[model samples]
Target: MAASVQIVDYVEQGQSLYIQLKVIDAETGTAVEGEVRFLGELLYGELIHEKKSPLADPVRIETIAYLKTHFGR
Candidate 1:
């Protein structure tokens, strides 16, 4: 199985939310595919899944928030 990550959102210093991620192949230490799964509730209380695939060179992707707790609430 390949390695994967789940990113909820990306809130800038104090701005709107966005998505970010990186891709890597564990076995060969190479760049692989990157996926972003956005999960949230709608006004009617329905679950939503917004997936994104970004093709680019290897780079570090991280959320703007210093800690996950900061966005848990």
Candidate 2:
């Protein structure tokens, strides 16, 4: 799988929210195709799936968040 990352929201240096899109192929190393791949309920945002085909779950796309995996823990 591949990841397309972007800062969804930012409010200073310490308060920023990001969104990583799962829109790439792992084996073929290509892009996934769909209209509404990433479906999130984070208030508001624009999410788009990659482009291409699939043999398995190349369609069930989603996003990732890095909310304090607690870097200094």
Top of the candidates by lDDT: 2
Query: In candidate 2, how many Å is residue 1 off?
Result: 5.6
Model 2 residue 32 lDDT?
44
Question: Model 1 Cα RMSD, Å?
Answer: 9.7
Q: In model 2, where do residues sit more than 4 Å from their true spots?
A: 1-22, 37-55, 58-73
Q: TM-score: which candidate is best?
A: 1
lDDT of each: 0.31, 0.32
The residue-by-residue lDDT of candidate 1 on 1-73, one tens digit each, is 3323344445443333334434343444654333222233111101111222232211222221222333442
Model 2 agreement with the true structure over 1-73: per-residue lDDT tens digits: 3443233333322333333333454545665433221222322233331333241233224232322231211
Provide backbone clash counts, one per model.
0, 0
Give the TM-score of each candidate: 0.26, 0.23
Worst 10 residues of 2 by lDDT: 64-73
